[model samples]
Target chain A: MMMFTKPHPAQTIRSSDAVFEVKDLGVAYGRDAASVQVVNDVSLSVGRGEALGVVGESGCGKSQTMLAALGLLPRGGRITSGQVLLEGRNLVDLSPREMRAVRGSGIALISQDALTSLNPAMTIGTQMAEPMIHYGGMSRSAARTRCIELLDLVGIPGAATRLASYPHELSGGMRQRALIAMAISANPKVLIADEPTTALDVTTQSQILRLIDSLRKELGMALILITHDLGVVAGVADRVAVLYAGRVVETAETETLFASPRHPYTKALLDTISQLEDEVSERLNPIPGLPPDPRNPVQGCPFNPRCDYVRDVCRAELPALADSVEGGRHPVRCHVDPFVGLSLTMASGGAR
Target chain B: MSAPAIQLKDVSVRFPIRKGILRRVAGEVHAVDSVSFDIAEGETVGLVGESGSGKSTTGRALIGLAPLAGGTVECFGRDLRALRQAHGALPRMSQIVFQDPYASLNPRMTIGETLKEVLEVHELAKGHDADQRVGRLLDDVGLRRDLAERYPHALSGGQRQRVAIARALAIEPKFIVLDEVVSALDVSIQGQIVNLLQDLQQDRGLTYLFITHDLSIVRHVSHSIVVMYGGQIMEKGPRKSIFSAPLHPYTSALLSAVPVPNPRIERMRPRIDVRSEPPDPSAPLPGCRFQKSCLFATEICRTSRPQLRSMTGRDPDHLAACHHMQEPHVREALSRAAQGAVS
Candidate 1:
């Protein structure tokens, strides 16, 4: 019986200090009658110099949660209910003009598709300098200098020479580095990277991960790394949050989460990699069934339909995240404890 | 070879690069540089490499999508060149599944019509029979029958890909070249589509030339793996042999860099550093193409070319192209840098 209550605030590793605190956040698109909730009752925090990996399948509300926090959800999307506290001030309470002021100055986002996210017609220098100009209120020459420094900081060689190059001219790895440099140019306290390395090859992916890891330490910046790659989370993230159907089903430290994942959905995701490694020819032990339509909402656990060990109570009442394994350090939202059948152990030293 | 489904013997695809107003041929970019491999019947051969490695070109050449400037492409004992001469083209044998599903499928046509087009082109079916077969093909690819009436825009990414797979099956082809088919899909959906492909391969006895940059999926699906670098085969062997005991430095680097889900292993594993940028195809290397970036390169390595050959004391299927592959020093270097981050 692992205790799964919210731990004392001090128990969390204050890598730098708390930078953002989100509580009972909900995001909806459009007005009341036309509203559609994309992210629901999600709560998360990013401590200074901490890398929190928010991982889930696509459309699992990881991106939407961060988007709500940043006030950047598309035209129709709005924060219906939530407390987004940045430096003890409520960001949701701010006016649009004030929120705009807080955006790049406080939080920056690196979108998944670098090609589309980046302005194609603009030179890398121009795009990189835009943040400094608007947020830092620097002159063109000063901003250009800062842009060159940023390009160099992110490991782009010959930054001065390459500043003239457009997004298309740079390679994928280079483009990502440039994007990271741009994101950090404003010296934002919180950085949200959505599938940052999904497009990169293995070799480049590791490089980018290392770069982000090192930069987080250097700048003492808090990070929310949203991705589908569990591999990326295992090595880098200090805290792990697993999302499914607009709800976070589990949260824990990286080591504890991997060693003893408590949620069935988490276990299934872990098993997927294990199966891949074991070279089993049979169909993957995937949680069968499509995600519930957001429009046609369901009651109780959203994953109940796909979970193998579903119970009657699980279908009728949503399980509150209770104490699980990891010495009562984390919480899990599942009917059965995940460790019952799993021979749970962290993979020992070798190629991962 | 027990009648290989497809074989490329010293095949090359070169495009003449023109410069200036006169458009004079300045040089030829050897996109596929005398690459050779074979896909046996009902066998899936995975071609893995970074961009510009010519994996896609090799796949395209097998299906006659790219013109071969040199060497031979023979399918089931029939020379494609001779067939082209006799029939003025090759058709309905090798179908390709491109990476981007949306770009591959016709936006205007419904899924039913897309499959119909494939059948009409190959003259496989017509009338009510054609309609019935189209629905069956969709079902074969794990897509719904109602999906046939929906346009590409209406379907999910995975559904559109199923439509592509359905169209590929419409020809009833023996060989299918899946070129990065699932790279664009979500990870969870990726597994579903990959499983579907594996099921289809087994049921139809299809031979696959699976081209992808994703080594993880390649390892799972391909029976044999070919690692390409700078348009040449760096290494090629049976999946187990190649994965567990890679001989080439390039292959060794590639396999180690693939991030496993387990954190401890990931942290402990050394990251192999391959070159950041792809090689310039137009510029011919003095010796081996990888020699410039390879840490093991010596004076001899830079002066002489290495042919793909088996390392002594290894299985004959395992082949690598490196002059120093059999040397103890080279092996030590490969193992030392094998798990390091991508170069």
Candidate 2:
């Protein structure tokens, strides 16, 4: 209903200054007719020291988009179209060996599960030093010294002794910190954290988020944080992108998105979550149905069935993502303007 | 008023920590220690805590799944142990739905078979009658009766959770231990399950022990709350009082750590400095279990364990285990922290 006119600090960065950008990225699985477009027409960018949050449910292809950018898609999964540009270099065109060289020092990833990510047999020191040695061309002794310093920077206590311990010996929080330290070992220009704190406790989750936020600032690295939790993104992300059915449904500055979400799906998502600051209501207004199965694709807008303000056009034609208001930075993919013709009664009522 | 539906008094649960090749009884790990609470009929008591805080253990102890080392668990004013000894099993009045619906449901069996097995085991119904009852159970949880013929792998996570809830309800239990039931579902689906749980509670007059680490969900569901840490009850009170003005430092810290979905409020909120990790369960400290992580810990907290006591200005039932809960400075600090004011 309203918009914040003030420009955010992250918004001031020009596109030329973007350290990492994914332009109209499309990823698919399987071959020909059997192929399922898991991510389609998705574009995102993060400037130096900026954090862009990609929020979506489990099957929305949030993870697959980043995996494509990393050139680590699973077997049978391939980039269908578009470019993954890291500092004006099109990573999609790079060869396997070249991509490997660009991975650690150019852009690094911190995945959700730390236990499985790190090698069990290898000591923490070994895993941390291997990346530094391979990417930075450092000697073994020097890499070991840097490993301890990185561990200390990520707030692991007794860092020197911890280097000798295995992954299983460390707690969940410590293991995550170790993974983060290793990710930033080569000081990449971009960092991608996918559901980094989903497995952790509330207290430990806060600590991890703070650590990641501070590291992004201190290193001046672009951050692409992918998660399903809005509260997590609210704390760390400067910009927020809401994804649905493998497409970007809405994108805006973090404050603007939360203050006044333009898309029907984004509005519904915000309503479904029970925030700590919100008054506990009698009943939650949950979106009535489940997300569409990607294999069995839906026609027109994928969210049309569940959307409260569904129109005939929404079911007939897919809406391209465009700026909602003239001269407004917020882009929404929807057939109808949610605020237009919205009655107070309809707004208060639950979805049909 | 009427005897509480479930009562736990000074309950303690311990598991042996065997050592060496001989499997000697080296020591014990107190999984639950001296925890006490009451759940009135048709009331929900939220058990909130970090992982390994013994919330699930407390739930298991109530249903006779875990062996109690000390104290008593009573159901409907009768001792649970006595009931178990007389009946050869705990009565069919209580049930539990675990966190992982996928793991809990059997993959080999169809959904129909799963519901039928529960009915047959309890001798609640027979062949034709079981089929009819199974349909109703699915309908009760808002699932299609045709879904009964499908296997667990075919159904979605939310649908599988509904099947799990249906199996729990087939026994016609008046009390259920929902251990992180909605934690596995997406945020939108979580609301659906929570609303379903609330609706079922009203229709059947069910009493629930809703255990979870998510604070907002707990705040929505529970009439009262219990905060546990390191196998001990840190605080217990009406939900309003606990959230509005928490007296225990651990409770305050736990609440503050929960991220608000709004960016403006989240950034302005003052977070209490919670030091290090949770306590080691094997070697719990002598005094306060939360002393190591608490910022306001003093010498008294190091030597003497503070028992749950009600403060002067709060509700009589509102209790906290903190030595300095009544002191002016500590109370002010905790209240300020709970109110999200910069101090």
Candidate 3:
């Protein structure tokens, strides 16, 4: 079930061919003593033309990890430590002035909620051109031409006329496309789309995903798709990273990760969502308890509270993201083997 | 045989499309167009659609929340609209649970106070007996009795949802409308809430009109499924048939659009791209409403609207509103199934 026949340490991939990489990244909110580090030592990379997905529940720090890399964290949110390297250039130490240069041209972000992400007062054309004029150093007329071309590229009909229309004038799908069009206006090397289609309809969702997939192919841009939906990640992502309480719990190629999850959290996440393919069971195997509060310091594994396969080791030592087998590159931070949880889950017959 | 717990017949919800400073009715907006379905006693009828497909409106109209322009809603052998008109208010036979647990619950009231208010308003329980019953309801939804003291903001999303369920259960309603109830929670928490609902349904023998955009949960919790598009019922059938074999093009497209969590299977599966924009509710196209997006749509489909007809030979409960029921796509799917069976 290996999608890419790949087994490289995420670091090796990051240090080597990665177009964008985040190493030992940490993010905190509030002051020093009272501050809570929500994102802790999270590392990830996306090879040029590769789609890497960061998936987790809310407050898992998946979004913060990416926002830190792009320097778009909310006010009061600070990058506590670590480096966000793009093509070997450290982005962490870059000043706000220098970071602004890299914001749209070096790396672009398509955030969730297109309605709010876009400026309500600006026309679609003006927003699309601002990125090009600022990052691409293009003249207003040239950027206007480029905007029209991008709108056409993103499959918006009557591209020239629609550019004059405001975001509110377009449908939900059209607004999302306009957002994507705006993000790629400067032709950045990396595109980070966070829950791009969560607000869209199922049919429209597939269209948006397909559009992103096609754009990645055509532009050869490194893609980081962040979402909580495993099904969405399974469709478009080359590799999958499962996050829990500000740390990576599992990282592997999509097919391998989905087929044989090593972490109990990953396995529970897989079993929790009811699939159309799966026969309707009497009850789903829900992992008990909520995600660990990021504000509270955790002892050992953060998932130990909810994990069915938790052992003494899970409670005593915080498992580092490490190779699971003698030669396996699939990294998993778990105290128990996959079978321990799988067999137990099966034996319990959907026991809570 | 017992009567169906909730039955909606030729239900159409329309709002006047107003314009200008005069606030005149220019045209009518068909929110729900002649949608019909029945929920058997202790049965679940999943009503699924995208945004603006009228699933929520249908659920609202069932409980007399959304004004129905036409058609009748009968709850346990009573005309719900007429009963509400005559009595000034219909008794709590049907209750609804909205998606946003935060907004649904009163922020000022504690969980205990909320449930107690429901009991008092409905005259189900009072005083010390009310507290005991509220505790039992809390237990039914898998929440601790002590949690009743906490306000909605103090509790987690899942806990607050369970309290909402307990509040609905407080009325002891025969029918419950779950409108995107689990859409706001996490995946793991969604599973927990679904299990609680299933357990509650079994224990209380309550009827459910489950409405949501998420099809997987619908398939999991529902005994029967109704696929709605463009404010119309495109397909309705037993869960087994609808999932295994779909007749309408829109139903098939909707099903295929959902990405499977299994990457290997998802990569190999065929996807039908519905390129057309979402159908406008204000101005629904003539003939087949899905014709704009349906790949198999032809001149015939564009010229004539199809009636919901039963599958004579297949499961008699299966019904699809499409002109080309005997199209080649079904045959091709069948042949593929045959090939699959042989291997």
Candidate 4:
């Protein structure tokens, strides 16, 4: 509770300054023994004009964590524990009606698939204007004019004509831009974009990421970018939290995390990707096994099975997310400090 | 030198756009337009492009899945059309693995049954011999032999993809078309699959048409790269030349757009301003397909389509289609825009 109230003494930006925060949040599906804990003991905070990238693969609880925060978990899903705070208010305990009010006006989400997320039946103008009229108390004509402006802000050319067009009328990139425009219509303090560019081409993906970054700074909103691609996060996020099997394995500044990742899972994930500048190697160093099943619930460190440097202790007991250097902002959830007493190249599974 | 494994000459694939209950042809969507390429024996040709760029359609045309509107496809100097006309069936020498393994696989069939079905249809093996081959195919793809009994639903996405690859290999093909095979898998699993594919290609001496939108992966696997846009070939060259010194503006734009994993380089990189979506294929445009988004587009570019001509000062195989590629200013502008993109 004290961790929630006061800012960390070691950190520059405190939790008190955070526009949105999730403290030790846990989410589960089903009931009793059969229940599956998809997200466990997750703590994250984002301040005004700051972007936090939550990086993880499929079934790593990246989407579940955000869904729990928004009070938008599908049927049978429940927030098992912890608090999601928007400014001063606890969102986990909010009523259904109150949560509805907070959605577009307080925190908005832009999902991965724009086609499905959008209402195919409604015109793009109607969808964009509805939130403005309902939440901002604007007239129909005023809302219509504002929709065009919002569309133009997201780099949609001929915004006025696009408004009257249906969702099917626009291309994939255009539909995504419309979705982003609608999400920011209420000018929420926090924006959660879950895999916004996963379905897009590289060209369109860059454009969307740049737009989101600029908008976050312009509106001074806290941005949570949830994606599986490390490359996408590298450009946008100020800080990153690497997740594995529903737990935060490592957290650090974006540059530090990429330059000197501490955890074995984090290092392995970095090595797996084929970088644009990388000289073609004969083989890629892939993590040995698949991600652990959430339903089965592995003991100790969830990534032990797949970790190249896993020890006996790793399989027996769970490790705390603690900083290797005292008072440092970088925290890693691994018992073995691979970098200790080793050169950076030697520690990174050199020539293996 | 031995003949090329696969040769495509002015290949075009068109799907009719129909209207009304009678389904009259309103127009034609040219999915693949005059796409020509040659894959040398045991070489991997990476066909890269965004959606609706005809990369996938071209892959399908090679395997006889997509009917060709014009031109000839020859495998090992044998005309595919002539072979199919004489035998009443397309040769089984070529195979393809689709992107979504789950959709491509049957829900009711076990992995063993799926592999066995391909053998049975091809008349390659049967009975206990077929069962043994099924296990070997599963092993070849790095899947456990026990997994042959499990259904596709029971397997993970990576495992299902491996099974799909196993089925493709069941026919013992000389050529394979992998259409975004690793696009659906996780990054960690994608590496495993990519490595597996490389190993298989070396072992079997397989000629591969690796079609994907990911530039990084294509650079890793391909000997030569083919850049496509709006269902037309924009550039074709050795992978290193294409990466190091791209002659086409569209190719430079694509190379710039790929986000590097390194934060420092990513932040410093200058993105080429190819901001608009790809040209609509259904409504064919006159002149260069990329003219609308091209940074160096001129009046001539809007009036005449450029042909894929060899670059004078570069590798003989390095070819690009652009009216101003030979001009020093255009080359300097492209290099300036993409200077910070990669290194």
Point to the candidate with the largest TM-score: 4
DockQ values, each candidate: 0.53, 0.50, 0.49, 0.61
Local distance difference test scores for all models = 0.82, 0.90, 0.85, 0.89
Query: Lowest-scoring 10 consecutive residues by lDDT in candidate 2 chain A?
Result: A343-352
The digit string of per-residue lDDT tens for model 3 on B1-343 reads: 5778888899999989889999999998899999888999998999988888889999999999999999999999999887998999978788999999999999999999999999988777899999999899898888899998989998889999999898888878989999999988888888889888888888889999999888788888898999998899999988878877777777777777787777766767666557687678898888998888876778988888899987667888899998877767754753343222111
- Our tally of clashes for model 4 stands at 0
**What tens digits encode model 1's per-residue C-alpha lDDT throughout B1-343?**
5878888899999889999999999999889998888889999999998877888988888878889999999997799889988998786677899999989999999989989987887788898999999988977988779888889998878888888888888888889999999888767677788888898888989999889988878878888999998898889999888876778888877777777676766677665566546678999777887887676778987888798999889899899999988899877766665434222
Taking the tens digit of each residue's C-alpha lDDT, what string does model 1 give over A193-283? 9999989877678788889888889998888999987878977899999998888889998877777776777877876665555452666
Q: What is the lDDT of residue A165 in candidate 1?
A: 99
Off by over 4 Å in 4: A1-13, A274-281, A338-352
Q: Specify the CAPRI tier of model 2.
A: medium
Runs of candidate 2 with Cα error greater than 4 angstroms are A1-14, A274-281, A324-328, A338-352, B341-343
Candidate 2: deviation at residue B41, Å?
0.6
Which residue pairs collide, candidate 3? Answer: none
lDDT of 1 at A41: 85
* Candidates, ranked, DockQ: 4, 1, 2, 3
What clash pairs does model 4 have? none
lDDT (Cα, tens digit) per residue for candidate 3, span A96-210: 8999989877899988799998899999999888867876789999988888899999999999999899988898999999999988877789999999988888878888998
Question: Model 1, A13: alpha-carbon shift in Å?
Answer: 11
